[model samples]
Target: MPSPTAFQPVATAMPDNVRILSFEVGHGECTLVEFISERQVAFRCLLDAGRVLPAALLDHLKSNPRPESPDLDVVVLSHVDNDHQGGLPGLLEAGISFREYLSPCLPAFKRLRWLFGERVNRAVDRAFAFEQQLRSHKVAVQYPLEGFKSRYASSRVTLSIISPAARLIKTLASGSPERVSALVSNSPTPLQWLFEVDEPVNEDSQALAAVFDGRVTVCPEDFDTFLPGPPGPPASSLAQQHSQGDPDFFGNATLNDTSLIVVLDILLDGVHRKRLLFPGDQENWTYVAAQHPAGLGIDVMKAPHHGGRVYLRDKDEDLPGVYAWLRPKTVIVSANGQYDLPRASFRDVLRTVGGSLLCAHQRTFEALSAGAMKQPTATSCFQSMGCDRGRGRSVTVTLTADSESADLPACVQGSGITGLAPIVVLRQDVTVPSEGLLRYTYGELDRHATWIKDRLDEARREFLNKLKKTRTAFDAITEQPLTSWRVLAALAKADGRHDLVADPDPVLKFARSQHVFWCAPVTGYRASPESFASLPAAADFNAARRWLKSIPSLLLIVESGNRFPTGTARVEILQHADWGVFDHLLAGKLKHPAPVIADEVRPVLLPLIAADYSFRLCHFNYPDSHYDGGKAFLLLQRDSVVIPDLLSPEWQVAWDWHAHGSPFKAPWKILAKLASEQMLAGTYLQTPYGRDALFNRFKPSTTTPLPAAMHKARWVTY
Candidate 1:
């Protein structure tokens, strides 16, 4: 079998570099940092392992010499949150060795018992068990305290603990270790426990800054903890009533405020080049502003708490959102749509602040945005390596005396097809159609298949082109002019996955589409599949087929023969239709004057039109809760309204809806009301500009035709 390097693409190394990788661990987070010196890995550390340890690190460990070989220098558990620390046990089971394990101190866990009643018993026991296992493995366990410093691998690389302040530890240890454990009572109604107050434990999370080659990166793990109690009730009456139903009900509200904020300063020889901040899930920006009154001029920031709702402004102080105060040029978010995060409002805030957003999982945001915006890059490693073997985003920054650079690229080529949209299909278990419906699509399956085929072909050619020599057992058993199927069999045998030879396609397809959410392509990142059949034996072909059926069908039936884009009407059907269908429709012929339509019913109207002209599409939709949906007008103007002219500053468009409320409320009183609700759809325009939002404007009236020998013009849908 060919060596791993023979098949994997080799990336050129920089002399001194720091590579920060965040994995797509469902709704969790696992990030890895590598310190490279002289084109070789000098040190490695992990911030969090997420719910399930990333497959990339697992594969690397498996390829090592033995369990004794140290794969990592340190592993930091951000907090006790299941989504953060759930994967540590798996990492330990993998026989991976590390020098140190950093996390919240043990005393803090003990104190949490009394503070949260018996709700934290299971979590505390799990933490204790994990610590015991690490001790058994002879790995040193350390609690990150403020100002703690350590040096490893090379004296040039250093780690400085920044948070979980000494004062916080003192406060935690002040409480008694012994507290009454709740006892069950037998009665007609179940008993309940109530608390007058609650303390935030998330502040005990580990926060540290690492300096390599004189460059620093800070990781403030969940510093949402504040010493003083919040203004509102500690735990709501509703929470007390349903506390038994939700495991983390009490801690949910204030947990984000406990996030420890980290700052990374990239400087070479004391000259600052860049600053990056990782605030974890910190929601109270006022705390951050208090800490840095001068303001943090950050170049990039990982959106706090997966872009959840944050307290961005301090009304009394008259301060701006943290993004605006810090003025970060780029905002990176790590989330996979759990609890509907990185929220739409959060993304809009970033755009409004002029910070370009980069998501570890682009499809997650794409589905959330619902075509209101598009995530431009597939920055996650899962996109390049195929979710089967590779995981998360790998953002590498190289620092040298003369230059500093940052690059995020997906290994494989992105899909050329545009306007590929996601469709939601309600599940059988769903009760509320609007909120319960799940978005489904075939995410990058075609690209993954093609990538696999290319690798097989490359391997076969290299084997055939070798110089003539005595054939070994490997070469003699194999046939000449090797086919792709034969190559796959060889790979399966090498990997000890014999089942893969029988049915490889289904197994790969099912695994490759795991993390990505939407049907469209995410750009950026450069890498390839590191191994074949990296996962355990998958279910049979029929089982995989059943799983694939969960994705919504893209096929659409064109209505009205004359109304369709091709003008052939009923004969034109859209099979596997993407959002690109809109482009074809806009360019295609229309039989009648396009009516003012609602954006909510765009997908619903696809199956009709050819069915009936007067069929009201809005009947299938729910009532509008707010006047959030605006209108778009596809006005036709000759060469006068060109693309560039519209983009110029002189022609900049702005709409102030607040200045004139309710367009219909005073339609006769205000002349502007006739077109105030209408926005420019520009069906014929195709440019990168104005793609994020439609330009709202007044519709213009047409004049009488006076050109000699004028011909009838055709119309298209917006």
Candidate 2:
């Protein structure tokens, strides 16, 4: 949350010929490739839609004037992996059409299993469904088989299928039901599927090559299996030493090895200018090097398998996965913490080889903070290499046939060690505070702070005015409500204020006053078993210790009876910090040490409200309503918890909460909203009162050289 010492605005240098946008789709893959000619879009190709479509891509499609016609020139489903092709259905649903749809065909039985009520692979199911939909729309669908070629007249671009040799397709057509059943029986988890050595569907993935002018880019959609024949005549390239590995390879290849290996090259007068490679989740580098020696030593490469490490034969013999002997200058990882991807080994290898990294998702930072990855270096690798965990951030790589170098954003460039892209704040400028307390520093943001304070005042005044103007009534109808009464009893036990059980009206009065409404839990009607289903039964409390791990402060209310006569109720409040003593009590899991007296229901009512939970109560004045007098209405609202740690990833979460108007204290949500608006307007860094104002309010300080735990959680300024 710092700006560069000196702001030097530089226009993004995009190549005229080709542009690639690798989306941040959270452990999925979705890329858009645009072929531009004379500043006009000659063709648009979508490479491997991710598990979900990125909003940017959807917006791009919707922006097309020709909704009735094909807006996209090509859609390449790298393989049937759900992460790669799941978004295709969404694209089809959006009414976006493409002239050509290239993918490997699933075996007939595999595609038809869904119809017979069998649990088919989700990837296969989606692919088959999409194919049917495309055919219905009169779109041309073709398998990207080896030696298959197509030429586009308008773009003068030639397309060629360079992978999944005809033999591999035939092997797939002869379904491996026995192998599939064995794998299914093994019950490999989703994460295990990525490393499974014998995932047949991935073996049949397509690798596509595109040629326009003097530039060529190959997209291998997870096609990493090496057959016993020549794929085709290898293209010409520089003779370079392949990455070294054990020559005697004996282990089965991972599903990652099935990744489509694709290369990008620029040539003028048959002279190689630039060479880049994009190995899709591939880990078997020894075989790829032996097969395609011409495309070694890439200038840029998207680290395969979301930057996962590869085990050659055994876990002890693990190697950095994406290195695969084809080291590149810049490595981009498109993944998140969901799968614990973009591993630390990837970072160590990059540092050793002097390569830069660009991470697309912020959750990667969370993984680092959670100790899922470890790095032992002087300065943080995330800072030096450049990372963008910013909201909706994506990495764009542009290449031109004329230039020998590909263009990357300044933040993620390979040339210099410029810490972060355009932000640099000295660590000495920060202030660290004790836990659970936040210190806000205004500095240059005095005016903004004052404005915010005034806005808070105005908002409070407005709320009071609305309260005075509205006619509201509360009827606590607590008759025949045993479940809710049990829940309230559990809540009382959890708060360690069981004395309130005998007199619960004080809690109701406190709730009606709205002083603690900021953190109070809001219920639609009344707390019920169905509403809090995850809560264990109160009788199971002692046995459900694991479920009591982390419980938030809450308010429980039981309302019952008819509307005409008003309602009767009982209310209780529970509060805890760090560790909750009776977290599982409300789940109906509390174990009583002694037997209870069935007929001893002494539910006393209190006239006075506790000072900790309530403020002065105000009466509602309604001239038109008959039920507006004396009846106290229990109005509960949800509030955002204040996160005192600036380095914590919760700042991003708080930002998101503020987006949908999650109720929070005045200045907190207001600051978030203002920061978001400024960022969207492209003025967060340009103005005097920039986003630093918002961050300053939440900023917690640490030492100059942040410890491992703090480093991962926070991005340092300088």
Candidate 3:
């Protein structure tokens, strides 16, 4: 008991230095982090390739000395959106091989297919190509889920995924394609013309615009109208003006919401540590703030969404629950003059909160370091704060294990704080349990089983209810009266029985004559008299009979019901020895066409009408029928086919006709009815000619491409 042997903590070795380089890629983002040990770079990580790699960054990497295996330790794509990943292909093409590639879209090819369907094929194709290139280059690819953590650079640097939440990714993966598309296309509500006033003019607009990296000029009057009756103590004129703009004033929410947020913990020298936040382009700051509220104070934070005002609008106050939790010493904005980024109002808020602001741009870098060693004068607003713009638009801060304050570049040191106190570095050693490590108690297993059973029972009840409704609907339709020959003829045409109507036989002639006046008003009805007129006596009656035999059961029912009455005569005709050859055809089981009988056609017709089922008959014309029997009888089984919901009320009356005769008055009416129904259904009635007839019937109108000027204008507005 070596009161002697007092407990002694083990000492851990740490890297000598950590450096971050935020590249000045115009209107995009690319950051490089290097871990140094023994005054030599041990590991390198590239956050994004931006829209394009800056020449300076590329030149630096190309010229820098490298180890035998000169490879990037990590290359994170963040999300699949263009801006974040556009330069990656070029980087790879430039021969920058990486050890690991992390992105949310890498393992989501199936989800991408489901989300985009075929609409965004080009985007999906590029994503797939990127993945293939990575694999071909032997890069390890991973789709990091929330809470994923990894140690790199010999365990001196640790990175943890803060977002997106697992549930959000699952929702996107499992959601309907249409819903996902809608979400991707989500945009701010269009401003009403009534509320859209002319842009305002201000004396400081140009200066403010330049200060914001020349993104957008401030127009105070543009937002003045949106101000409340009286401003609260914390709500300044700037706050009201900023709040007047759209929530998505900086960028759309779709891609921004999927951003990969990470927290990096770097051991500077054993006991001293530094925390850096790289929140890709995450727009949902509230979620991040809520998830990591405490122990998240960091030395540096890359301002999210390119320092857009959406995250920090109120100059007099900090963002709700965010600023207090983070308390970042310095904020870096990686944006150039494009789409009005690095909002001036946000910079003002950052200054109000006593946090240093740095822009990843050449102009801002030069401005900050213009008089690095000089004292503040009346003309220099920024000089009061000892601002040190690190060399080459890159800021570097270092902390030593024994030092109480951070050692930063002379450009980054503000006048008030010559040195920064070491921030509390929170480390979470998350021991992810393996599959075998998961040991569920019996109670948990039982609870899971009960939940699954309840779900199955609910599904069963729903399915049974649906089945009951279907059966009831079927029964109700079956009890209706058998449709007359004329109505059946019309429905047969409507249900795609053009050949049945084309047949120039005696039974059809008899039915047509009986309903001559009855056929006039039927819409989509055409009496194909030309077919009969052109027919020669020797024309293929065998072919016609074969065609009749091949018709489907629903059509056969219509034909038979119209050709013969529901009586012993019909049964006798069907049971005739000559009709035996057509029995299989009537049962909808005919695989090949049988030889047609030239004289025993009546026997073939009997099988169609002998069945006891309700039918609706109408007189209509099949415009595209090869055989034009001027007016033909069409038959419809009440329950077999789905009627177009948008058909005219008159068509419904015609369908429900019980007058034992035709209910139509004109041939054009038939055409109109059929055209309207087909248009509404967006498909053609199935026929031997297939979808060609439907296409011919309802071809979309040709649209002329817009002029270049008009197209450009439309897209600008969009």
Q: Total clashing residue pairs per candidate?
A: 28, 24, 48
- The candidate maximizing lDDT is 3
Estimate, for each residue in 43-138, the C-alpha lDDT of model 2 and write its tens digit: 677778888888888886666444344578878776666778778888877877678787654442242231211123455567778877887887
Sort every candidate by lDDT, greatest first. Answer: 3, 1, 2
Candidate 3 lDDT over residue span 462-481, tens digit each: 54365456644232222212
Q: What are the runs in model 3 whose C-alpha is more than 4 Å off?
A: 1-15, 106-125, 177-252, 310-321, 362-718
TM-score of candidate 2 to 2 decimals: 0.40
lDDT of each model, Cα atoms only? 0.41, 0.40, 0.45
Q: Predict model 2's lDDT versus the native.
A: 0.40
Ranked candidates, highest TM-score first:
3, 1, 2
TM-scores for all candidates: the values are: 0.41, 0.40, 0.42
Which residue runs does candidate 2 get wrong by more than 4 Å? 1-15, 62-69, 108-120, 146-162, 175-278, 297-299, 311-324, 362-392, 401-718
